[model samples]
Target chain A: MPVLYGSYRSRATRNLWLAGEIGLELELRQVWQAYRLDKPDAPDAPFNTRSRGFLSLSPMGAIPVLVDGDLVLAESLAINLYLARRYGGDLGPRDEAENALMTQWTLFAATAMEGPGLAIQNVHTYGRADSEAGRGEIADKVEALGRPLRVLEGHLGRDGHMVGGRFTVADINVAEILRYAQSHEPLLAEYPAVDGWLRACQARPAFRAMWDRRAAEPMWL
Target chain B: MPVLYGSYRSRATRNLWLAGEIGLELELRQVWQAYRLDKPDAPDAPFNTRSRGFLSLSPMGAIPVLVDGDLVLAESLAINLYLARRYGGDLGPRDEAENALMTQWTLFAATAMEGPGLAIQNVHTYGRADSEAGRGEIADKVEALGRPLRVLEGHLGRDGHMVGGRFTVADINVAEILRYAQSHEPLLAEYPAVDGWLRACQARPAFRAMWDRRAAEPMWL
Candidate 1:
């Protein structure tokens, strides 16, 4: 079994979601972010990204590191990509072209959407929406996000999925990244296709299972 | 031959570098960013990102779109990974584990380093370093970049390569992203191992060939 280090509230949620989809069991070791804990440096505190053990696994101190056999991987999306390609039946790429296409969509989500999505998510999650400056930042981030969202909206209009005309890891990765902005209902409403596609993706039993576990986990931030 | 869109001046330069390494000949098409043109709306304007043909290829209007056979893939790193997997002998992943590791490094470069690297590069290239505000922005970006660079420095300190203890697409992808910040000598000097690794990567004859082509290209920014 693969050893996954991170709490469900962390980026590890996506990996768990994919694991649920494939029924691949992972030895999940809960790790938190130091900034999220009140007493992260305390000796009794749980293993976190700042912990020496976790740092040795990934120097960047990122969550969602997957240790499958000898292959230790980081980055939530990258982990999912590897998992899907390795253990996922039809959930993975079926050919070289599909592999390239899936990689393209994954990178697109990471580079083009994740930043603005996180910014927008932070504004809502951290109570920044109550402040004028925070609201202004959200507006700016939403505008910055419009271009890529429009592209996704256009692509989703066809076949209603990211790649292979089916729900592969591509859809899961992109949908999760886009989920950061899901709180802004009005923004998502602007793209009906994207809205519908995202809903379908989240409606999956695996995603619901993951979300339930995530909601049950303690959120420090 | 694969049809590669974008000029030698665009992100296509990296793909060209990888192609030089693997001896894969691609049909290079000259496409510029509309923002780079003096009068983008002019009918006589060259085929650029805004052109219907280019947009049809990639709706995001991104350059460096690769059309290998039937695969129309965006993202420079994704294209290189595909090319390397298909044609690169030792330059590509030899197995699934190597594939996952390479993908992780590529995403790390894209999501972690590219933003600050580009910020620092723009500050230098656009002559923003002449002003206090620009210099401050450069300093801030350099600081933001240090964490990921430190991780990379530690990794490169291992076997002088990204994965498999040899140069692969991982090295190419990371080296290209780091090249954006290479103009800042003082910043790179802090990570001696990173600096040494990047130097060796750039010193390759394939990179030199690509650099020569890029130098001869017209610049708008």
Candidate 2:
């Protein structure tokens, strides 16, 4: 059994989705904490430096860490890839070329999509929309994100899925990041293939269950 | 033969090093364009909205994309992994756990090390050291890098190498990023294991050959 540490509404949402897809018995450990940037000693501090388990799992004190006995893993993308590879099913690709493609898209999501997606999150979820600095940052990010989205649109324009013709962990990881773009940008009308692929990803029963679970959780930002 | 686009001194350095390690021939294509942050007409510019090849290789208009016939791969880390896996001898690990560890560290180098490492590079190589903003940014980044450096110190403290206790693509990926750190921050005396591991990586014959080749090339940026 693997124990996943983080909240449902967090990046842990993807990990939960992965667990569901792999049918792994996962114990969800919710660390109730709040992150006050100014107050360093707040008891409910999110990513509390005092939590030994979190610190042990992730020295940087971040979320979405998976602890499988002694083999602890952090970094959500790495966790998803590890789960897919270990479970040994269709979660990843069988062919070498396809595997390379899977990695390409996964890295793309992390490097290209994440920056703007984080900026969008900072604006909408954290209520930073009013500040001139915040608006400038968001505008810069939005411009930065367009080209990558177009590239994704072009790739999906040919194939229904990202790596293989079928759904894989690559799709799951990329789609999870795209959700941030979809929520904040809502300009999917310009990219038909991306919209179609995202819809296809959402149609998964496992994804729906995870989304519902996330919707029921209290918002934290 | 694989065609690698970008200069040897750029991010493509790792791929070139991996190619040397695996005895693979990579056709190097030099895109001799200055990186203009906000300009529109720089030749071979990555973010130039007009460069089709740049867009095709990297949607974000970044460099060092690998093209193996029709299959194009971007993201230096992913490209290195693909090369190592395809032309396997010692480039890849022998077992599943080692392979996972390899992937974990490769991803860590991309996400954890690259940002601050680039900041350090900008300060030392491009951004004038005397400029207040450049110095301040470098100081901030060096401080930010301490946590990841400690993590690397912890890992190397236990094992001599990054993965499998021997050299692999993980070391190549991480070593390249750490080389930037070494060049920029001479105050790296506190982390002994990291320093030792970096020296070990640089001591490789192939690495030495690549470093010499890079030294002969004219500086860009």
For candidate 1, the clash count comes to 0
- A197 Cα displacement, candidate 2 (Å): 2.4
Per-model DockQ: 0.86, 0.53
Q: Per-residue lDDT for A1-221 in model 2, tens only?
A: 78888788677888889888878778988853436234435555555434665677666566677787667777778788878877738987787777788787888888778867877877877778678887787778777788788888888887778887888999999999888866555557788999889998899899999999989876643
Clashing pairs in 2: A34-A44, A34-A46
Off by over 4 Å in 2: A32-49, A57-60, A186-189, A219-221, B31-61
Clashes of each: 0, 2
What docking class should model 1 receive? Answer: high
User: Candidate 2, residue B20: CA error in Å?
Assistant: 2.0
Candidate of highest TM-score: 1
Q: Please, what are the lDDT tens digits per residue for candidate 1 over residues A79-164?
A: 99899999999999999999998999999889998999899888888888879998899899899889998999899997688889
- Candidate 2 TM-score, true structure as reference: 0.87
Error of 2 at B98 (Å): 1.7
